[model samples]
Target: MKENSTFAPKANALQDYQFTIIVPVYNEEENLPRVEKELLAYTKIASKKTGILFVNDGSKDNSQALIEETCTRNEGFNYISFKENRGLSAAIKAGFDHVETPLLGYIDSDLQTAPEDFNLLLEKIGEYDLVTGVRANRKDKFVKNMSSKIANGIRRAFTNDGMDDTGCPLKVIKTAYAKRIPMFKGLHRFLPAMILLQNGKVLQVPVQHFPRIAGKAKFGVWNRLLGPLMDCFAYLWMKKKYINYEIKSKGC
Candidate 1:
């Protein structure tokens, strides 16, 4: 991945961190301040030392300004902003492409998932190739929540990945597996399944969920339901021809 519009990596300060959390931002100016506070607090007690990488997905708002300001004030905060608005999956793909940590995690700028709970996923990373969250007591509205449930069911039927909450943004994965994923516009919904395609294991643990305290909800009934429904067919096509191999004999 090329350097984003602007990024200042402080190697001396970042050398101690063993993990990175990618927070994808898109017109989320209202949440950046709280994201800064929560992530900084998380770094203090992360199971493995961690830092934050804010991927600005071309927000046509003040999000990029706020991200730069936060990165300047915080010790381990850094960011890469896009030149034009891309979807969430593109931001996640950018995160995977640039993250250089052994363990890479992703969270939403909306703050729906708690950063502290990253530890919960981190604890199980040693045993599984991927660790994702299943939100316990989600705080979304009744209609939205119901749509999500139906969407998840449809996704499971297609992917058969057995993940109850692929919609949950909180997740940690080995960087090796993450970087290998063939990312597309909506492939974020199929992360666990993609890992499975690589003959890897996945574990889902319950994590805390919060209602949107700021910014408008980005998705509606159409994208929440119909979007994943469409991605399912895409996943099926990829799964059929996807190849995985292990070399047993090598001389170097």
Candidate 2:
């Protein structure tokens, strides 16, 4: 779990850190400033000591420079820049691999989802292994909304996860359960389902949503609709072979 630490490392164990908000960025130069501002503000008032981790998903634009700048300027801010763009799932996988905090969170670089809603997810973590958001009033076009609905319905039928909006950007998950997920291309859409495969509990709570303030949406109908539908087959395959274990006895 080695990462580039710009500032002093925590004196206590990883559990001492309450949460590390992983914001996956890919060519989101216009949104970095607001991302920094909102996340920093959230950290200030967060019930737990929250840290911001900006995962630069091989962004070719000026997003990396601004991310580095913002991370350096803030105390609890940090980041990892990939050599090449690997899409959202890879960036999120990297975040889950490196994040050392007790709770792991994810938000989009685009501010369509509010950072403050993370507090709501955190409140439910004690009762469930994963607590994700369902956008109450999604601010998207008719086409996008309908496509997502169709996709969600298809996924629910396949995985039986019963998640309304797996596409929701805001979520808080127990680090152990999160790190165990076998992430793939459309991994973000299957987070709750993956948690269930691990025999972990999942709970969804309604959260606020807004239209994109900056940068165009990275996913379109193909990725949101066709991609996830294809991933459902993969999920079925995984679920058939998924393993679960218990350490009734152990020796070092």
Candidate 3:
């Protein structure tokens, strides 16, 4: 509930902010300094006024202290800490639950993706409910890239969402649509599909990608390959049972 004061800090106040960029951190102490620098710069040139929300997924390292210090020094940076490790899906879900902006964005703390490219996605968000980045000239290893390709192919066959790279972390989603997504394990892989379930428009724009400059990657080839394959089945189940209803009229 730590609302960024760059906009409106008090309840029932009109928030001037247009977006909240959620950075999910988990034992990424080595990269935090650079992350702070890049994101702070991005905010200055962003298409709309932006706030940073760091969801600490129970990092055992010195990340929480750094996050606290960053928030304290910055005008629009804030964080929420979990009591224990809950994986990436939980971190993202917590972010969605707490975000109050009109638009919400997601980015990894690893810095593989450029924060500045967010403006590119933001430019198109008005016409779509979700705008996700497809990594252009991805700089990952062969195994990593190949595994992701296979996973994406399998996901396409099942979900048929027409997304080239659903694993891209750089994305901007309308807050109303994002909050409706029922997050599960591997929720990140199926974000566009989830938006489709809500009868929302989705677009994928190419963005810059880089190799991991710091911190160990949380996922391996097996994690990248097998985990998403299993999650596709989960998505199928959820899709079958998901409830979507629209009321043309409402009562006060």
Candidate 4:
């Protein structure tokens, strides 16, 4: 396989089967190798056909090169690099756009969420348009954990998605519904609500969490607390004004 090559084997278990896992990466060079190894292991044991799509959000570090090298060596791994740094939402949206698969999934490169637990979400994919991981035991600083808890509580009170961990990186979503979601700066936080906008069902399962073994956290007080607070109002506006319709008649 050539460096930066994008090739994934088609699965034989199911006819027309395709599942893509998108890992949005930014300056996570230290974690890429471990992420690659774990993801490859998970792909082997995944319930359905699987491949990896890494969205390089213009990391200043060696993340892109590592991603390219991994994709070149691993047939199941593929990647796309951005020209400049964009936030996590942009990377995720880019992944959703490029993937051609029945099922689309995402996990952060931070290693805080175990990739193996993706199977926990995938097991329930058949029943829900979105299957999200609820971090069973979050491993973070007290401040970060508390801030996230408050943010999640506020989100649930407003959006009513009833998800305990919308911020959890591990998720499996049906691609058809995922593509219809409107993208915004912080829209990644509202994934469950966006799926709910389409009247799609969402399921949450308990998944393991771990401490970040390397790199710095991308989010701070502004993005974690105040940012989400502002985005909640945006979601409210979108919820009220967002349009959804169905065509009941066939074209002649």
Error of 2 at 37 (Å): 0.6
Overall lDDT per candidate, in order of appearance: 0.90, 0.86, 0.90, 0.87
Write down the TM-score of every candidate: 0.96, 0.93, 0.94, 0.93
Those runs of model 3 whose alpha carbons end farther than 4 Å from true positions after fitting are 1-14
Cα displacement (angstroms), candidate 3, residue 110, comes to 0.8
TM-score of 2: 0.93
lDDT of 3 by residue, 9-67 (tens): 33332256889999999999999999999999999999999989899988999999999
**Model 1 lDDT, full chain set:** 0.90
Candidate 1 lDDT, 27-131, residue by residue in tens: 998888889998999999888989889998889999988988998888778888887777888889888887888999999999999999999999999989999
Error of 4 at 82 (Å): 0.6
Structure candidate 2, residue pairs in collision:
none
Of the two candidates 1 and 2, the one with more favorable TM-score, higher being better, is 1
TM value for model 3: 0.94
lDDT (10s digit) by residue, model 4, range 112-131? 88878878888898989999
lDDT of 2: 0.86
